[model samples]
Target: MKRGAETRTERRDDAPRDHLLDRLFRSEAPRLARFIRKSVGNQDEVQDLVQETFVSFVAAARTGKLRTPEAYLRTIARNLLWGRARRPQHRDALHLPVDEDFEIAVAPEQEWMMEASDFLRRYEQALAELPARTREVFRLHRQEDLTYQQIAERLGLNVRAVKYHMRKALLYLDSRVNTDD
Candidate 1:
């Protein structure tokens, strides 16, 4: 039967589905939190949005319209991220001084270079924590600017595996670095 057309009797008759929700709450919460952390740029905001996303998911399920729960949760988080980005406080904080009068005239050259070096070092450390194959593919594509086919050829991995590794590595680093930033 179509989901919404199910009789009220059938809705109450599902015990296994209730157990499934219990398990989902335990298993999916942390994973969703991490995903939200990666997609949004702040830790506190991640926590808030995680709660909001799950609450929305539960509400949708109760209303009998959540066909793909995980995807729906992620879509909620993506929307939250965009909303946060559009807020006035965030906008003001992120504003760049683009006027000519804002140009730097007398900064020491090595200052910016040292900051860049430190940032790259931290970034490399995070990259190094990934699986060896994932790291290798990432560096080849990002640092060496190699195409996925080139990366696959050099590493002897199938192109699909390379793509999977890239996605995993990016998600891992996203949760780790973006949260702290």
Candidate 2:
């Protein structure tokens, strides 16, 4: 067999038999293994998890229940990693009461996210109302990290025009953002 070639085997017969799966495996195996190794932190077990993921994929493909190859592989890797974590030996490695010194934190919930989303909407609305050239000048300065002189040079405008655009953008944003708050 040539280097990097897959060896056809009988175990793969039960699956729906797509050449794409072989192609995907060859192309994605290294990346899949790296992702698993990052989560599990075990150099030795990384290849094992990747193999098990493919085995699961073959089983899933047999059932005609496959989705995107990358997503399917990720789901399988996650399940296998969680299974490893649930083992009795590993489970008991942490038995704890609360650590008062280090408080457990909760993920940000819906209201905070909604407020942020609303703010972004208002900000976008404000930006959208700016004149085209003025908006471009402001974006070049802020987003592209260009100085006023550089922006002026790029847009073929004088430095005073660039500064005027910057001030205009800032004032509009300030008015909109403050009123919204």
Quantify all predictions' global Cα lDDT against the true fold: 0.70, 0.73
Which digits, one per residue and each the tens of the lDDT, describe model 1 over residues 1-181?
6766677658777776788777877877788888866645568877888888777777767866455566666766665655654455643343365786786443332344344444555666788799888888887876555679889998888899889989998998877655435
Clashing pairs in 1: none
Candidate 2 per-residue C-alpha lDDT over 154-176 given as tens digits, one digit per residue, 9 for 90 to 100: 99999999999999999988899
TM-score of predicted model 1? 0.41
**How many clashes show up in model 2?**
0
Name the runs in model 1 displaced over 4 angstroms: 1-18, 94-181
Model 2 Cα shift for residue 105 (angstroms): 26
Candidate 2 segments exceeding 4 Å error: 1-18, 93-181
- Worst 10-residue lDDT window for candidate 2 reads 106-115
TM-score of each model, in listed order: 0.41, 0.41
